[model samples]
Target: MDHPLLLAFGLLLVVEGLFPLLAPQAWKDTFSRLIGLRDGQLRTIGLIGVALGVALLVSFS
Candidate 1:
């Protein structure tokens, strides 16, 4: 795409889809475990993901 935002979003989709595409069972298993996690734990995981994503975007761009 002509826009950097579109390019980044497309890359994000590709990366997000790869794991489930390659290992559907494993992907399901991961979410099954995630379901057992407490809300706080899930929040922490999500926060970390966001932080790292921001860090990577800053460093790369």
Candidate 2:
């Protein structure tokens, strides 16, 4: 596709689906644990993930 954002989102979907598709039970367990985490803890995790993604993109580019 000509749109880089669209392609990136599509790839993201594929990667995100892999865990659930390959090991549904494990995914369910992990999700259950995630649900128990506090909002602050989840926000921290999300921030770290975003930071890592940005770092990777910066390094590659």
Candidate 3:
């Protein structure tokens, strides 16, 4: 339902904002390090994230 979807998005925003809100310097440092990663490395990380998300959705559904 729309309610559940909205709650999911809200929770996602909260979780995504935690690092920057609680440890801004650390978050910036992480971004700086990420900037040095190769495109292939970034792609691999993204693929893993997508795969994990899909696996979680499948298990939950």
Prediction-by-prediction clash tally = 0, 0, 0
Each prediction's RMSD to truth: 0.9, 1.0, 1.4
Report the number of the highest-lDDT candidate.
2
| Residue pairs that clash (backbone atoms under 3 angstroms), model 2 | none
User: In candidate 1, what are the lDDT values of residues 1-61, reduced to their tens digit?
Assistant: 5799988889889999999999999999999999999999999999999999999989998
Which residues of candidate 2, in runs, are more than 4 Å off? none
Query: Which pairs of residues clash in candidate 3, taking residues 3 or more apart in a chain or in different chains?
Result: none
Compared with the true structure, all predictions reach lDDT values of 0.96, 0.97, 0.95
Candidate 2 lDDT: 0.97
For every model shown, what is its TM-score relative to the native structure?
0.91, 0.89, 0.89
Ranking by TM-score: 1, 2, 3
**Model 3 per-residue lDDT at 8:** 82
